[model samples]
Target: GAGVSQTPSNKVTEKGKYVELRCDPISGHTALYWYRQSLGQGPEFLIYFQGTGAADDSGLPNDRFFAVRPEGSVSTLKIQRTERGDSAVYLCASSPEAGGPLFEQYFGPGTRLTVT
Candidate 1:
């Protein structure tokens, strides 16, 4: 895909199961982001990565959520000991280096997670 892509568009799991959601960003985009959206809400930022390191992770709810972008291309969002409130759509976005209009991100279709 020429734009960002998210795998496993929908996920259903028990309340305490662990899950990993993946995102593939546009080639050559050096900045990537993760966001989560619950029912009837806008996407909320989760993390931002520049190159292979996390530049900002304050959006993560707690230690139960983590993300990594080892090669500056693909990123994985990991959730541990999930609860029913964890159910939401996980979104991935990317942009070029943060300068001028390139700082704006392009978002991918989200991955829907459902915890039962």
Candidate 2:
């Protein structure tokens, strides 16, 4: 079976533009997560979804960022009014079940977004 995948491996946009990053998780994985990784920094948690609803979105930096998993499989991360500070590699991960200390997550290659 295919693993988690992210589209548009790289993206470049002007500041104040809007961009969407997509992710497809493994079939039947009930938990999905989004993260942002900046230069030399660890991935920062953005949001977590269980099934078709968001379980935790506290990691989202601000209102400009949002994500949805309408059917409990594929998800999209939407960024509005992009800024230079938003440039980073956006990563997606999925686990067999909900995230916990014992569950392992599979990760995608990530979509690199650059706002110039």
Candidate 3:
């Protein structure tokens, strides 16, 4: 079974451009998370969706970064203005609801975004 998947393994764009990253989590998983990692640093949590709504969005840097899980399975991460400082690998992970033995999450291969 597919664990978690992301399209466009790499993306390149000019500064000020907009980009949307997609993540398709494993079927039946109810908890999904998004993260961003700059070079030489750990991944920073972005946003999390427990079902059809965002559970914790405090990790989003600003209004420019947003995510949606309208159907409770697939999710999309939207960036308003792409900047060189935003260049990094965007990651997605999925797992069962918290407080369960299956709370361990599985991460997808990150999508590397580059703003030229």
Most accurate candidate by lDDT: 2
Give the CA lDDT, 0 to 100, for residue 17 in model 1.
93
TM-score of every model?
Answer: 0.95, 0.97, 0.95
Instruction: Estimate candidate 2's alpha-carbon lDDT, on a 0 to 1 scale.
Output: 0.96
Which 10-residue span in candidate 1 carries the lowest summed lDDT?
95-104
Q: Go through the candidates in order and give the clash count of each.
A: 0, 0, 0
- lDDT per residue, candidate 1, 37-89, as tens digits? 99999999999998999999999999999999988889999999999999999
Q: Mind giving the per-residue lDDT tens digits that candidate 2 earns over 21-100?
A: 99999999999999999999999999999999999999999999999999999999999999999999999999988647
Ranking according to lDDT, highest score first: 2, 1, 3
Off by over 4 Å in 2: none
Candidate 3 lDDT over 1-116, as tens digits, reads 88899977899989998999999998999999999999999999999898998989999999889899989999999998887989999999999776566488889998999999
Instruction: Give Cα-based local distance difference scores for all models.
Output: 0.93, 0.96, 0.91
